[model samples]
Target: MELAVDAKPTYEVGARKWLITITVITCAIMELIDTSIVNVAIRQISGNLGATVEETAWVITAYAISNIVIIPLTGFLGDVFGRKNYFTASVILFTVASFMCGFSGSIWTLVAWRFVQGIGGGALLATAQTVLVETFPPEELDKANGIFGAGIVMGPTLGPVLGGYLTDNYSWSWIFYVNIPVGIIAAILSWKFIKGGKKKLSGKIDYWGILALIAGVGSLQMVLEEGERKDWFSSNFIIFFFILAITGIILFIVRELTTKNPVIDLRVLRNRNVAVGSALRFAFGIAIYCSVFLYPVFVQSFLGWNATRTGLLILPSAFLTGMLMGVNGALIKKGISPRILLIFGFGMVITFAYILYRLATPAAGEWEFLWPQLVRGLGFGFIFVPAASLTLAGLKGKDIGQASGLSNMLQLLGGSVGIAALNTYITRRIAAHHADLMSNLSLYSQTSNERMQGIMLQLQANGKTGEQARQMAMGIMNGSLSTQSSILAYSEGFMMIGIICAIILPLVFLAKIKKGEIADIGGAH
Candidate 1:
């Protein structure tokens, strides 16, 4: 797989430059927001569409699978059709699909449209990042990345908020409808203003590579998304797909390495910075998204917070982190080592994790989560921008698209894998905790006997028969045991995640640190 290095060039400075930046980033954010936006609306959607909760989950799974599968292919698509045309086409596809998704009468129809939306949406992200990279000179890459990074950070954080509000105030369909106008505007701007990143006729398309990608990534994503509900390896569906995922991925890797004119270049991993940086990005994805996955469920499931309240609680901190991404970029350009920034970032994550572990309980209120969420946002701000800088620091012009695509793909998969693993961990831990707590609640303990006697006496005073009151007291104890077990499991999960961060911290020091550059960038034409 050979890279075609285009001569470095720059667009004329002025209104057009900033306009392109705004257009690309808006489209990027819009696509990203859709990724998580549907999460808060699943219950409403299932009820309205007359689908089972299990069936409605296909809407999310379809989008997620198609999105990750197409991400690494965006670079090749851009090279074939030209980035401007490909991007504009993507936006138009997403917009139309969103409209269709809103109006669909059946659950499968909505899921089909969602898959189409994901294809377009996936293209927008890495392609937009590459376009943003080409817009600025190398010296200003930090500022450029700052702008791009902000969108990535805000999109997921804002998704649940926007979705919750729309679903609560109007209807679930409005979530899809909301993207229509933004999509139209972004498509128009991209067609009229975006430039560069086009290539001449290339070798035969890597058809097998593409299929392998779909089979491998699609199957793996399915396994991750549905595994917990289906009981993992115990389910035949999970077992079949797990086998497909491993076999398909093995084939895909081999095909990419051996093919001339590969669908997505595998050779970029040869760069030390790019390789190490990609691993770090995957770790960061788990750290960021697992918390996002854990917090809402833990609060809603155990703490009894509503979806909207949980969304709002996480919002302020997410916004703070978005702003801090820009600052962290500038600091990198000012000679602060990315390694140092990463260490600080991981330290904050560990700190946030520790606090969350200690604070989580069934009786904990919303306010207890505030400062920890804030610190997490701050940590992400420090981590994201600098990591991007280090990843592509060694790549030539032709390699940027491929590197960006691969990096983004890894991040997405990491999040999926992390969410699945964390959930399974909590489930097993909860069972163990329940068993231990059950032992303590037995009549063998003096305190247990006293508590039961008190409950029985209180119930009897409320006019219940003695036997009925005793039975009710036992029920209350069982309920308390279950609740306490769940809370303990979540707390332990948080500490385990923190330990994982601490273990991966050494990778930051191993990443190559390149001095910031100020070279001109070529347009995507």
Candidate 2:
């Protein structure tokens, strides 16, 4: 197998390019929406399928594992087959699988279909990115990327809200059913508008490398998605996969580095911008996904909001982000440095985290959180556009697809890691907070005595007998304290995220782009 570089294709923008862009973006949004849509429908799925809470979680995990495994391989597949043909086939596969998922009768059946759907859906993401990049000239790439970025940002933010509304108003199956119409439209548009790339034979396909990659990423994703539920490494199943992940990843890297025709071109990472951009992408993934996950859980569990209410609470941040993405896109076109935007984005996100840390309480209201979320949304707008543009700026045309695959893979992997870390951290924090709270609740303390007496009086007034009343009063007191302790734990978790983002801010200075470069790039548009 020998590596070859060939002449790059020229793209002309018109109706064809815009149509193709819309088709690919639609496909991309569908894929991303599926990733988070199930979060809100989990309870309904669990009850309807007669699965336990823990077992039902496999529905999400199975899809995620398959998605991560397939994303990196998308570039290889698109090259092997023609891009348009590959894109069409993926849509068909995803649509068919979604139908099956809706029709599934058992938990295992649904999980199986979700995994199949994920394999198809995963290609939609990186392939869509590559397609959009190549469809536009380098000059107009920022605007193209901006549109794609908006879809990426919007999908996860909208998923929980949409899913919640659908599940409450309709049924859980509607989640999958909703994709059918979107998929059909996208497929039709893709066939009509997408221009296929001329395929160059890059020697023999790296069979060994593909095997190692699947073994590595698939196992690692499974471990991350399920580890918290399985009690981390203590479970034999988790421990076994942990070993599999490490070994497979090591072998995959070695194989990629040594093989002439690697399934994924790990060598592209040698480009400095690509490498640093990938790291930042990873961090961005962590921050975004972890915040989405934690904020809903914190509000619902401690603030006692319903799914609909919690979903609505997040909408303001997302709306603010949408508005800022457009502004940032224009700013890039007007010769602004992305590094400055990146710093501002990071600062706003850290500020939002700090606000959450300080304001979260058992009795905290929606108004308390409104402004913080809006600030966080503004930060996300800053981070997404510039970070995305810079990541691919230095890569040659032939390497775009491979680089997109790798960067997207890191972002997905980072999300899984972030959620697992946040869940585990919150769990540990809850215990620590409870312990500290209990230490100050001795009966000898006047404050403790007064609280106990008040609770006892309330119970007696409710018509309980002496012995039963005292026990009920104690239970109520403990419940109140536990709720307060949980709030404290959540606050600490938010602070930790704030500190992590703050620490990463200095790295923005390391991103090297010449002054006036962005202006030159914009002027080319």
Candidate 3:
């Protein structure tokens, strides 16, 4: 249990370091779970608040956009305000916003509070890693990263399960309300025990970079979230924002590269491992994030499962993933090649996706998802921890903050993009399938005629007129057709995710990380 004599100490060593770790990890998990917890409650929110699905989506979109805008700014803000002060302040803001979000009577009111919550939430995510790396000795940073990766995987994995149980058993507001007590305890611990560090604040503010970042990231998020709603590029709304995304991104890059004090240092990507690791991270984001989003919606919408069942279906896999984090951490400490783990993880990911694709159906029960999801759980366990260690292995000091910010920001952006794109794909696929199925439905078709006749007779026997019975029968038929189309679309979507993940397999071998270099990082302190 003893650290080496010459190890660097950012705070008091031993007991306090572990306490600080627990405090920040608790807050980080709270913030992260909030990102996806509301997903299962969208229906309850819209019904209670009288908001349409489109209007209610803003609840999710607003939070996502805010996270994108604020994440990269965290390093800069931490330097201006002491890290502990900024971190403690963020916990207060997030907790208060959570309290307010639970009580909002209107959809827009909830959206506004969620946006504020995301601002605080984004800070916790960006700064918590910095604290972890600083808390442990340099060689033990991989162990720190293993612990940090647990929160990342667990938060999103458990969010829907917790959200579903709360929504079905209590009310949707409980999702937000649940954060209040936990947030208060975390804030108190973080403030009282965690040490604060202040940076020498002398750099000129990069206002242009800040502005460009806001415009670029904000516009890009808006485009992805709203593209399907507006019919994509066909709408003038989509076209205008596309221009802003491109122009703003260009300007942001130019400003950051030229500025004396950049808000986020883009130059970090020039490193070989950092650059390749980022792309793989982004791909990892799309794979895990998109599958989680798609699988739940598929079961809920087509299979007639309640929120609770849908959430529970994936619970085992997530827990398996969390348990594996420690397992991988042990492996990393043993100097096992991260490349081998990553390749194995990616292989499992491909396997998980393909299995899900093969097994997905309108009638899939919880048992059907059990094994595939477990494979996914194992796959993520290998993928997340090692991918993170490899990407961050080369960074030191201030660059760690900037790299962490950039890596975290890209993953968030990647998740949002994946959700948006997959949703759009499902929408289009459903429409096409629906049209194709409709073309085959006819009174002259024997199977269609008998099914319609049986439905019509049942409705008539229940006291409907002939015309009413006919209308009801058609309604039933159309509903069934829509469900079938949606189920097929989701299956294809899962297969597509598998293919995309498989394409990234080559990156595992190409990774610049050597086993010895990463091993030194673990014991170097």
Candidate 4:
């Protein structure tokens, strides 16, 4: 069955176009916010449900597993059902799941609801992007990208802030409850404004491909999200998932390439721009998500900042990134090479990382981080629009949906890899630094003795006996050493991200993308 490609593609105009843009972008933001919003409430969630922190982490992991599993399938699903119906149904599903999540009495119940929410959330994100691209005419695609990019950058950043505010003032459940109103509005608007195309498939649905996708992507996502927690491959649980991920992914690729009607068209990668763009998007995901993950944890865990303060610290940079997205789009529209913008983006990211690396110390203040974060904002702003434009550039018809899904999948998977790898790296580095520091802490050395004496004297001055003071001095010294080790480990992690960006920087030139090419809506070909 076919939807004839010879027919003219229509785009929304005037207030209708903008309204459609707002509706899709809003849905995308709501999905993204929920991705990270639950993070800040983990402690509260654990306590309220009488679950260990480790058990409650499934609340996050379950959602992530379902999200990645569903993301790449959205394009295929959209084609099977009309895009409008699929998009609106996803919004309703997400809203209902969110409501159920708030009412969950146990950890596993909440996890189940979160998983369902992620299914809808993932569809919302991928379909929303496709909607935005199709809603604008080819010439104004850059502008559509700007609006969509703003939401992309703003969503995860806003999650923690919004979640922190609600959880602190109200309850942990409010984080899920908050999505109800936004999802309702988005669903209504989507149904009212979005157009649906009648699509008829010629063959049976790709049942094997769908199952393989779930096993492959779902298991892989679980590995990334839960690997460090499960102690990597040492844990049999991780090893089992790791095996499943490899086997499932292999079957998935083999089946997709051979199937008459693939769930996701792996053939999209045959296009050079899509291939290269997907790779760069992976790096982009790493840069953005890891920074968001690293900064908040650093401030709140080590710097002793509260949730609100940590979230606020990230606010300015996020806003700056949002503002710059439009400028990047305009520049692209004016015929600036996306490669140039891409390169500039990477350079700024490296600079931001370098600055933060230099400034990572136990005594570093909010002001020091503020400046580098602003530079990061500049990096993200420049990167977001250009990378997206380049990736989907020159694709038309069904390829657009396929490419969008693949690119989004790669980016999300990249974030998972970056976070998991960096978390493991930092943990190992802390132990190494602790050992190195401990080696120099010779009790026989004059410097060590002086330090010990000073600590003991301070303890005594605070009204302690010599024996008690000596033991207290040891504890204080150990704590100080641990803090310094952590600081060093974190500094190196920043550089690791910078090096990743630097490595991916050269791939920008490999793509055969034209200087000013923007994606054509379906039927343009």
Candidate 5:
């Protein structure tokens, strides 16, 4: 995937540069926000569309499968079509799909449109990063990265907040509807401000490689997104896809490496920094996304908090991450070792997970999460800027697109795997804890008998017959047991994330890049 380079280039200056920055970052954030915004609106959407909650989940699954499928292909797409033209078309495509999604009369229709939207959204993210990289000179590359990193951090954080407000006040459709105006403006700005890449593919298109990528990544994403819901390998549907995922991935690796003109250049992983950096990003995705995924659900389901309130509680942490993006970027530009920053960052992530594990009780409130969330923000800020810098630091020109595409794809895949694994773990833990608690509460236990008696007496005093009181007492005991089991399971889940981060933290030492090398790309001042 070699792209031709110009002998001399012109850079956007003054207000023009800032305008381009805002345009690309806003588009990037918009695409990312769509990734999780629908989560909070699932129930409402199901009700409105006359579909079961289980059926409605395909709305999310479809988008994720298509998004990951297209991400690594963006470099090839951009090389064939001009970057600016491809970007504008993607914005327009996303806008149209969102509109169609809002008006869909059936769940499957919405899912179909969402798949289209994911293709566009995936293109927007990878292309936007490449544009930002080329927008500023190497010396100011950190600034461009800081801005893009801020969007990446803040987009998912803000998704639920905006989705909750719109869903609670208006309707579920409004969540998709809100993107129309933003998309229109972004599309116009993209075409006007972004530069065109003149490079075109000189060899035959690798159609076989493209199909293998779709089969491999799309099936794997489906397996991750739907495996637990479908009972994992117990379900024949999941078993088939799991096998396909493995087979397709193996075929893809072989096809890409052996093909003369591969859709995605697998050879870039030969670079040590790029390889280690991609691994770090994969772990970072798990850490960042698992926390975001679990916290709101825990608060809303167990603590009786509303979606909006939970999202609001997370706002401070999101802002802290955004602020830290610039700080970390500047620190890296000033020759601070990325390895040191990475170690400190992973340590904070471990600390955040442990603190949350300790606090994962039914009684924990908003205040308990405040300090820990700030620590998580620090973890994200530190990890993101330096990880991105280190990943692309060793590459220039065509390699930049290839490495960034692969890096982003790995991160998203990591999130998918983390969410699935944690979900399954929590389910199994809940069952185990429930069985242990039940065994101790048998009729032979004096403590269980006394507790049941006390509950029956209380029910009798509240105007229940003897038999009724006994039944009510039994129900109350079971309810308490179930709730306790859930809390314990969630606590274990948090610790699992911490352990994963700790295991991967050692990889930072393996990523070697000189100070200021990230800023020294293409020899531009």
Candidate 6:
């Protein structure tokens, strides 16, 4: 596989480049923030719109689906049109879509606007990374990545917090409205400062490949997102989509491998670094997303904290992650190997998972989670910068864009899978735990009888007749069954995440990077 390096007459790292980088990063962060920000406001939107909780959830799913579908094709689109033109257009589109989303009166209308916003948002993510890399010289790539990584990590972390605050103090529409000004600024800056790359478009676009990719990724994401709610394969919709997803993905792989000019160059995977990096990126996605998804639910449902409180809990950890990103960037600039850092990061995440598994109880407090979450944040920072740096290090000019798109796609898909699988695991475990708890109850057991009697007396005192009290006591026991079941489910969920990290640990050795590979890679940065 011959690597194509499209090196233009290099320009100095002047004010223009920095300005462009900032603009691109800002756009990327805005898009990513919206992805999770709506999560906190789902209840408000549902109540106001008179939609069911399940229907309002489409607001999230629509954006995610459109995002997944468009990300892999960003490189192609950027090449077809000039990068600057494409990027500027995307900003305008995203901004307009945001307005529509905010003004939407019905669930489907909001969903439609979100989907459009996602289409524009997806382009920004990969293009922003490429813009940053090209703006910096090879030597300063680590620092550039550090800056980019900060935005990536901070966006998701801040989303819920910002959304919670906005939803509480102002209206939910403001979440979408907030993007208008940011998008306008980014668009103007990008038009002024970002340079266009020179890539000639072929005669015809790979429409088949685009369709295949959309079908494959879109269907797969839908299955992952809605599988648990719809009972996986049990629902007809899920089953049909599952088959479509599998078929589309298989066809996409075949089509990309065979097409003369592929929509997304799958051939880039021939580069060992890109391949391993993409895989590790998938794992990174799983870890980051699972923690984000589980933490809020754990705090809100089990610990009885409100959304705002849960959002605040993650603030310190986000700061830690931002701090560590800077530190890791400097370390990479020095002669430190990412392999060592990644090992430590993996261990830290496992430790964090174990902490949660052990400390998790029905009554676990916020204080109990503070230190562990901080450790996890540090671990995430350690992995994200190095993993990203190492992944794209060997790729040349056009390959850089392709590799970025692929890695981003895997990360998104991994998150979807992680959330779906964890939800399913929690649901199943809850049932099993409830069964075990119920089986332990017996009339002959003194403690069980005493507990039942206390419940019966309490019901009677609450104005229940003797017969009603007896029935109410049984209902109380059943309710405790659910309470204990939930606790056990959360505990097992944490353990499952730990086991997953452990399973992936050995793959680090398979990365084929030597002790000093960081310097070799860093030199290209």
lDDT of 2 at 15: 80
Give residue 390's error in model 1 in angstroms. 0.5
Please give, for residues 183-271, the per-residue lDDT of candidate 2 as tens digits: 98888988777766536665788889989888889999989988988999889999999899999999999999897778887998887
The Cα local distance difference test for each model comes to: 0.86, 0.82, 0.83, 0.88, 0.88, 0.83
Candidate 5: where are CA atoms >4 Å away?
519-525
21-68 per-residue lDDT for model 1 (tens digits)? 999899888988998899889999999999999999989999999999
Q: Model 3: per-residue lDDT, tens digit, 1-525? A: 111223444434778888888988888888888988999999899999999999998998888888889988998887778788999999999999999999999999999999999999999988898778767766676778878888887888788989999999999999999999988988998899866555555666778899999999999988988898889999999899989999999999998888877888899888777777777778788887898888888887777888788888888888888889878878987898788888888888889888888889866788778899999889888887787788778665566677778888888887888888888888899999999999767967999999999999999999999999999999999999988888889998998788878887788777787664542222211
Model 1: weakest 10-residue lDDT segment is: 516-525
- Number of clashing pairs per prediction, in order: 7, 0, 2, 1, 0, 2
- For model 6, the run of ten residues with the poorest summed lDDT: 516-525
Local distance difference test, candidate 1: 0.86
lDDT of 5 by residue, 183-207 (tens): 9999999999998754755688999
Position 269, candidate 1: lDDT: 91
TM-score of each: 0.96, 0.95, 0.93, 0.97, 0.98, 0.95
Model 5, C-alpha of 38: deviation from truth (Å): 0.8
TM-score of structure candidate 4: 0.97
